[model samples]
Target: MEWKFVRLLSIGQIRPGMKLGKRIYNEEGLTLLAEGAELTVSIIRRLERLGIDILYIRDEVTDDIVLPEMVADETRREAVKQIRTVYRSMMNDKMGRMSYPHLGYSFRKMTESILDDLGSREDVLIMLGDIHTTDHYLYTHSFNVCLYTLTLGMAAGHSREDLFTLGMGSILHDIGKTRISPKVLLKPGRLTDEEFAEMKRHTELGFALLKDEPFVPLLAAHCAFQHHERLDGSGYPRGIRDGEIHDFAKWIAITDSYDAMTTNRVYRRGMLPHEAVDILYSGSCTQYDQRKLEVFRDKVALYPVGLTVRLSTGQTGVVTSVPPKTPNRPIVRVIEDEEGASVQPYEVDLSRHLSIMVSRIAEN
Candidate 1:
């Protein structure tokens, strides 16, 4: 189908590979197709041409994890609403005090279906970051992990089966945490030594829970067990060496860490997305898998909209969008002068202006 997010998504234009988004309210804005689904790359480029910065991805969005784009197409919203229902139920059955082994298989298959849909085009915005969060933090974290891992898996060219396995394992990596005590799980201060030890048991606990499922794929157990294991063998449960670690675990480790650190928690405020990228970069020689660490620099947004930032020239403003091929530095829409006085709106490409440096990226 000829893909376009025009006056609205034209019916004839909705084809198998064309990524879709629907404008929900003219004044209120847009949403993606649903949680866990990605927009095809072609759609992103077309939207870019229209001077549209936001194209909705189908996935769960959280209150804390802000989606920079507020407006989206309406057709995309309907598609995503159904997807949200499916994801909510799948996670509930798997994590809630319920037994639904059969649902696990369908849930995994659903992940693969979401991945193969690179839209009909090569480029699309897979909803990796825009997750909707509620009271269930651990479960929400698992869902986000699955969404992010699938995006990285496709980017790294993993086989179809491998991607499916990765998604399934990631979605459940934290299941063991559900078994931990609520006191330790929700503690506000730094974890005591004893509390830390108890918390660490989740890895082993997670492994035990997943190892024997009837439909569990090969290595699903290791994914839960070894996601915490590092290349340097400093990780918990068992400090297995890198060679002993499966490639699947390696991929999960990077994505898992990235997601965990960037997200907010009761114990600590989360790092900015760019700061999280720096952590992954620093951990490369030690804990993180080198290859997998790259996904952050490429995919994660450094300066999300509404975040305040300082420029090398002493000017400051809100981030607009990271210019193409220049993600490290973005074009900011200036809001104030260096002295904090109000200023007129203007755009500057930090990538093109060598004199302009990002002194620091500060989030409010």
Candidate 2:
């Protein structure tokens, strides 16, 4: 029904039309859904009281979807964990003044290192098919923006200095949000004009904060200032049109918006990856740079490892690897049948098996 990252998922909230990922099941085949002590009617009522919706048991699943452990490196793994922690802290701090000193440099440098190998492709895909699902919301958006920016810069054949500049810009793009009021930031409803204006002031405020940083890059200031500026002058802080905003700034805005929309917000649920793409499609080249967005679709993996998704066969399965060039499709391991029938484990590659498609996206 919607998109949810594997990390925030609770077994107690399992529902129909949702898909399961490899992480859904543990080494012993017990799932988060099977963690609670009992599934009795009284227990269900207790779960509901606690804001839980449903529960699931590990069903029969295909095996090939799980990747061999060889590809995941320990150092990269540890770094990824740290990125998530910092991202959440920053998101919570967006309402007012907050301290997050090293995040920008760290995010920029780390992304640069990772993209070094993925850059220079015939195409500008910054991630491999096998590795691109980001779990944390804020940092993930930061990372996604940088990823797209870097790759686009490369495709446009910018120099190393320019590439690094793009990275810095993307990471700091939302720094202005640090000045918005808390209630308005997390309001579970649409923002009022006054509240929205308060939010808009963040762009100018974010720019002010970085104006004095001694070693900060120029685009970093622009990132905070111009990321929200639109090609048609519909963006905030200023009525800047096409020639006013830099190519790199525009790139970050497009990636940033797409990532933010597909992520879970307190007031609203995230759009499915495919759905997010469709929404972006309408604005591509108009609100966004068409070429860069297309390159983004190439690098970003919608069905990342350890996530559950639905199949066209009316079954649910977990995603393991990225499919070749087909970011829309991926390798999946079946876990359950349409009737919720128990089935054995098996793997299917959407790229190889064109007959099957990711008919819908279900949450973990």
Candidate 3:
């Protein structure tokens, strides 16, 4: 019988004869491993040297493993296309640039469709974990931030109309970046002081582009303007205090930072969901809204499905599911024992073990 279960394991966990269930790619758009290829120790070591973290492998023991996607692939593709259109149209010229009235209806229509689709789902955590075009990072990042903000809004019980507005603001929050010099914006290395200053102007530039448009709401424009503002008045352009910041801006701040940090750029790799949440928590109250940050924390998958983790009790397992009440604790399917011996697959509820904590994420 053919193996039906497929699990995403780190490169370190692969053994000879284990068949790849998915193709692997380098960040530069080259295929490194083909699907259905049996992994050998030498090939695995090459992947390690190349900085590959995880691989989908078909195994008899994990035949039932499944990882759920955050949104349908079709919907994401359409949204990205729409964003690219709006961006390209606006970047055509300074004076004769495409107007918002022309694009506002279509933009809202797309946002509504996205909301309609996401609203039908039961999962709260928004994971945009998919391979994307390295060249069109802005458009993809915009769509991701928009969806994430909408999910966070839903978790916070925003009304339907409110969700529509939030979605609109989020998708276009970084539109101003299109006006920035490509050299500084897409620089693979750290920015110089003046380049960094120029980069920070995206907030005001975006707001200026959208503020006068009749169809765009003032609230949406504010989201574009103040997304970088901090609770402790440390943010740029305005240096506004907590009370001075708008609600949607606060929400977008968290979403924007989270998405930016978790996406792979030319210079850095994407972080795991748990690791991203930890960074959000570290900046709570000082850099982000504390209450909103907590709401975000509870909604994300702390131990996302297919992630391998090591437990405090010296056990290692793959996270199978996240318990709603205790997101930090998940249902783990243990595959290795304390002595590092292969064991019969067994499930453990992490919440039940008061003393056991997730020590670290295991490299795939």
User: What are the clash counts of all predictions, listed in order?
Assistant: 36, 10, 4
Residue ranges of candidate 1 with Cα displaced over 4 Å? 1-100, 113-135, 362-364
Mark the 10 consecutive residues where model 1 has the least summed lDDT: 57-66
Model 1, span 172-273: residue lDDT tens: 777677667778876755799999999999888777767876666657767888999989999988998789898888888987887777655544545667
Off by over 4 Å in 3: 1-6, 10-59, 92-100
Clashing pairs for predicted structure model 2, backbone only: 20-308, 21-307, 21-308, 60-343, 61-345, 61-346, 62-345, 62-346, 63-346, 129-322
Error of 2 at 302 (Å): 3.0
Poorest lDDT segment (10 consecutive residues) of candidate 3: 127-136
In order, the Cα lDDT scores of the candidates are 0.59, 0.59, 0.78
List, residue by residue over 70-90, the lDDT tens digit for candidate 3: 666567768877787877677
Residue 41 accuracy (lDDT) in model 3:
86
Instruction: For each candidate, give its TM-score against the true structure.
Output: 0.68, 0.65, 0.86
Candidate 2 lDDT by residue in tens digits, 100-149: 57755665566566456445334433332111222223444555566567
Model 3, residue 168: distance off in Å is 0.7
